[model samples]
Target: MAVKTVKILTDDIDGTEADETVAFSLDGKDYEMELSSDNAAALRNVLAPYVEKARRVTQPARTSAKPASRGKSESGLDIPAVRAWARSNGWPNLSDRGRIPREIQEAYIAAGN
Candidate 1:
């Protein structure tokens, strides 16, 4: 016996069959949606002026596994040190891995550390 898998894309806006998936970003957030040709064209038309005027920024290539130095934030602060300070100061339940909350980062800086 043989089986085939079929994938269908429905337009996010109007529930019609989609021709393609559109990817966009706003306010530092990434988003993707399946859109029919008409809706996709409309979206492009609306954003054309802004897109023409906007500067394109290229993202760094990603690796499958994070490097050991990934703990450092974009601001170049030592994440391990921040975690240690947070744990000792007030955030005893802070996780050992993953991103540190923005509030904690701000507080760490505010405390002159």
Candidate 2:
């Protein structure tokens, strides 16, 4: 299953702020994480590549016939690249699943990731 979105919940419980425990959802499954501010920054640093890659979609230069097979929507990105892009953007669970769904493929292609 391809992940649709990532939802992060950072509300403190019982009005206590002792090392926040953030709750987030990936593909509908919920998980919690507790980390220091430094760790959160580190995590954002780790995810920067994926986020940037998704934000910037450049069509590869082709000098010969038979360019990379574009998707139905013609996103110009191959399937592997799409999957990797998704995984890098907080879709780690996709590794266990085979063949990204049509909706996800469409979104990935549409987003030019």
Candidate 3:
């Protein structure tokens, strides 16, 4: 039998919350999972740094709006709500230059336009 492998884009690179267990690719592609888990440690290894960065970006444990570790506000658009929104709507590609998340949230802050 062939070692099954899956082609997950890794949410961190795609800019979402932490790593998500992908049952299948977003485009509905089939995966030949090599490990018992859908996305294994080896797979996560390649994406660990990005995942850590994203994890720190939207730390669910955080409850207050504070400056990001990267030196920017934590989505001025209501941290918790924006975190949920980003998770739901897909964390869009924004500049990770500390300003990106805030910039993206600015739209939400100014919503109803």
Candidate 4:
């Protein structure tokens, strides 16, 4: 599934600060960093609260499910380029030349590559 939006909530239970006062902003916008500039350990007291809050968040739900179709996937039926050629040549509906589901015709053109 596509993630369209995100909501963030941070809490400080132990009066810890993740970063220095450099995190404060004008309109409730704050930046709390987990790693220091030198890639050293962060101040434990500061980051613990945000970490706990993060753990509370629920992950998004799973999306589409499809059962295994034996040999169908191996047939290359879902190949995007092959599908494009078939659709472009009036496979969905037979043209006046009456080529429908133009897989074999497409293979002749593309040599089934």
Ranking by lDDT: 1, 2, 3, 4
RMSD of each: 5.6, 19.8, 18.5, 16.9
Candidate 1 lDDT, tens digit per residue, 7-94? 9999999999999999999999999999999999999999999999999999898889955776688778899999999998998888
Runs with alpha carbons beyond 4 Å of true place in candidate 3:
1-76, 92-100
- TM-scores for all candidates: the values are 0.60, 0.28, 0.23, 0.20
Strongest candidate by TM-score:
1
Which candidate number maximizes lDDT?
1
- Evaluated at residue 1, the lDDT of candidate 4 is 81
Q: How do the residues 45-95 of candidate 2 rate in per-residue lDDT, one tens digit apiece?
A: 877787777644456887777554444225444767778777877667775
Mark the regions of model 4 whose C-alpha exceeds 4 Å error after superposition: 1-66, 69-72, 92-112
Candidate with more favorable, higher lDDT: 1 or 4: 1
Candidate 4, residues 38-110, lDDT tens digits: the string is: 2223444566686577635455887688566432334445544454566565555534332224555455357
